[model samples]
Target: MTGTEPASGAAHLRWRPAPLAGLRAVAPVLVLLVALLVALAVVDPGFFDPERLLAFLRRSAPLVILAAGQYLVIVSGGFDLSVGAVVTAGVVVAAELFNLAPGLPWLVVVAVLLLGGLLVGVVNGIVSTVFAVPSFIATLGMMLVLQGAVFFWTQGAPRGYLPEDYRMLGRSAVPGAEWLPWAVVVLAVVGVAAVLFMRSDTGRTLVATGDNDVAAGLAGVRVARLRILAFALSGVAAAVAAILVGGFTGVSAQAGSGYEFQAITAVVLGGVALGGGRGSVVAAMAGAFSLQALFTLLTLLGVSGALESAVQGVIVITAVAVGGISWSRRATRTHQPVRESV
Candidate 1:
């Protein structure tokens, strides 16, 4: 047993990579984003001008915010098909509320939207986790419910107007900082918070639960609660995105149409695993930017807008397939025994 035997302890202990290793996971998405930006600059150099670039970021903010929320749900091993519907509902509801209460402060409207989003998320969580329903089914049902409600409420078109201040969040610059759009500022805030959250104990536990719920539960992690939190956060993100979209593009029944797929595509593009447990929030947001850049570049090149959805579909399928292969290979390497001479 002593001659060239592998270490017994090495065989017993699971090998884990260094914490810093995870940081590199975002590199690919960042590279892709940079390339897209470069292409955009080549197509329309004016696109890089400070004012135009800021404006571009302003437009990209809603999708970026949605991607952040989707990242939470997807990373927790669940899907939130309701976020797009939530955005539509939020915008329509807010407009209606303002119509009824013309003097309602924008802050009040914000609070209501956030609370509603939270409520929707909790329902999504309870239905999926408590009732043992699959998250995909639960969220899909929620999407239908929201969409129906929006249609009934709006009667095919939004009936109310969003006040200037309310719309400012999506379109205007900070009151005193003319150089910064509110959307950019909000994006910065959300980005910082998400990065910090992912680095925290709770965030790590959430990731662990996504990686392996049984193992995380055994380790004393509250798997259900975390998954619910993921859904709730996703809902809040949808609400915020709704506000931005409403302001940026104005009210319409289809304000958030197709956004769910776009957000998912952005998340996948950022290298986030569809099944969850491995990805960076920064990368997810970068993926959103890259997506927006690609669209802009296409437009500059006279590509038909109808092709956006097709591009997203292709990107999603490719990213997921490549990720599956990469993960399979890594698993194989990780499980292989280390041989050594004693």
Candidate 2:
């Protein structure tokens, strides 16, 4: 049929413009998931068991949630390379708190979550904004600082362990029970909160600022505040996720290692723009799940754990390339101004 199409009954048959870009963006992830499942099934049929799979997800929950948090900062025109360090710091802080004399109460744990996250967020936001440092450099420095501090505190190892109470957040405390992992629960809670936050005025402001800070500021969007909040929110979310991860994996010098890249890759795979100002929180979370699936598939395939880093590197490159191509296409469309001849 012609583009304008026919009368009532036949109009329904007229082809709608396909969601081609959306489909394309989603396609790789879907293919990857399918490939993973096939590989897993072929490797070991027992890998398909629901219980084992759920447990697997529990393990992935923290990284996925961290991805959701990083999406906010990146979409709002900033990077948070410090997230891996922030998470490591968070776990260390939690462990230290629990190690204190007289054994701290549960309230101290809650306070630690809130306070630790806010502190890190504040530092990231302030350093980036006030010093006018590029987020990449700022966060990179922050990561080093954190790593050094953690090392100094622990003397090259994590000094303490999460108490049984805090460990419950990680899913290991459940023991023989098959209930939802605490990591998943924490992810769900933070993930839902992030979705809601993105829907609020602050969220919109963050996106607007990311898209064009000059325009957003002229429109009364408090650009600096929004950016700071973005980093802070990310910091807090990382803290919460750290609890789960630390509990699940147990404390080590490597706790929360290399997670920043994982989270960023997940966000990009979910279709968030790299330079910011586009995408959804839900999609970001979906990206997290997709990453987890990829890792799981790799594990099932008997791929060496050593290869996981290589796989992550490949995913990051592919996602960034896709984002760049999309940006070029959009820029081409938008910047082609009208011209006239005399």
Best by TM-score: 1
Give per-residue CA lDDT, model 1, range 101-127, as digits (tens).
Answer: 998999999999999999999999889
TM-score of each: 0.89, 0.82
For candidate 2, what is the TM-score? 0.82
What is the C-alpha lDDT profile of model 2 across 133-244, one tens digit per residue? 7777788898999999988988886766777776777765345654656566666677777866765668867877887788988988887778888888888878877777
The C-alpha stretches of model 2 lying farther than 4 A from their native spots are 1-48, 172-178, 319-342
lDDT of 2 at 167: 76
